[model samples]
Target: MNLARGSSDDSGSLLWGLGAIALYALISYGLDYRARARRGSRHPAREALHDLKDREEPQSPRHRIVSRVIMIGGGVLTGLVAYTTSGTLRAVAAGLTAVVAVTAWAYYDHRTETRDSAG
Candidate 1:
């Protein structure tokens, strides 16, 4: 599929869209893993950054669900903007933006089991 031309087929574009979402998810997961694995390092600056990525702020289960919902909404909004305003190039940029934004947000906000919530 030639994404440069912005494939005329809706099916092709839909697949690309789903692929973008999955890519973002994978990046976010990797960042979380990296932060956790390197958390014990003695470097202060790196530790501080990783701590944020490790979700230093305690979040309830409800907060986690809401954050995920909002992140999905953001991706959908940016994807629509990129597709409508430009072509495949902009769409690719949108995917990159989503990856970074989602990864950073996931660093501070994450999924927690409802059963673990004190409420």
Candidate 2:
């Protein structure tokens, strides 16, 4: 008996799943943003262990806005690709690719800021 069945029209489920993942990611990001903002980026672990405030500061508004835009755009791209392709795997792959691209962009931006600060 072989049970490797797959549907070509699983776009509905794929879109739903992608939306759920994006929603989860957005919530996580928002919570992290708020927590870090409130805590002021100081290493809580070190503060607990050595009683020191974090010298590093919270990210700026521009950074937060850009990150949020990436997440939203990724979600939209995932949905659109899924709708157009009508294939579960392809849609998922597209969504993942979008997320990776957004993350890489953010990382590059962050590295540039770090380099600018150092130099």
Candidate 3:
């Protein structure tokens, strides 16, 4: 299927959409696995950071701003890429990629925070 030209068939578009969602889910799962594995290793810097946070909270306005910008930019990029091609499969895949990336990031973030708080 040529993705350069947008396909107008509803069936094709529906398939593409579903495929994209599935692909995204797979990618997110993969990221979760990697994050889980990596978390097992201890890092001195991370420990130190945790200690510092426990002792005194540091305000990171810049960090918050950067994170928000990245999240918004990433969402825009995903939408653009998903809609760029004409083929249903391609577009769906692109959209799925974006979803999975975001999902993975959230999962990793949650895990890290949970672990940190526990430790």
Clashes per prediction? 0, 1, 4
lDDT of 3 by residue, 53-82 (tens): 343232244443443454455555555555
lDDT of 2 by residue, 10-59 (tens): 53756565664565455435444554557686653443323112134434
What is candidate 3's TM-score against the reference?
0.40
Which candidate tops TM-score?
1
- What's the best-to-worst order under TM-score? 1, 2, 3
Model 2: runs farther than 4 Å from truth? Answer: 1-57, 92-96, 105-109, 112-119
Q: Show pairs that collide, candidate 3.
A: 3-86, 5-86, 6-86, 20-92
lDDT of each: 0.58, 0.53, 0.52
Q: Which lDDT value does model 2 have at 56?
A: 43
Candidates ranked by lDDT: 1, 2, 3
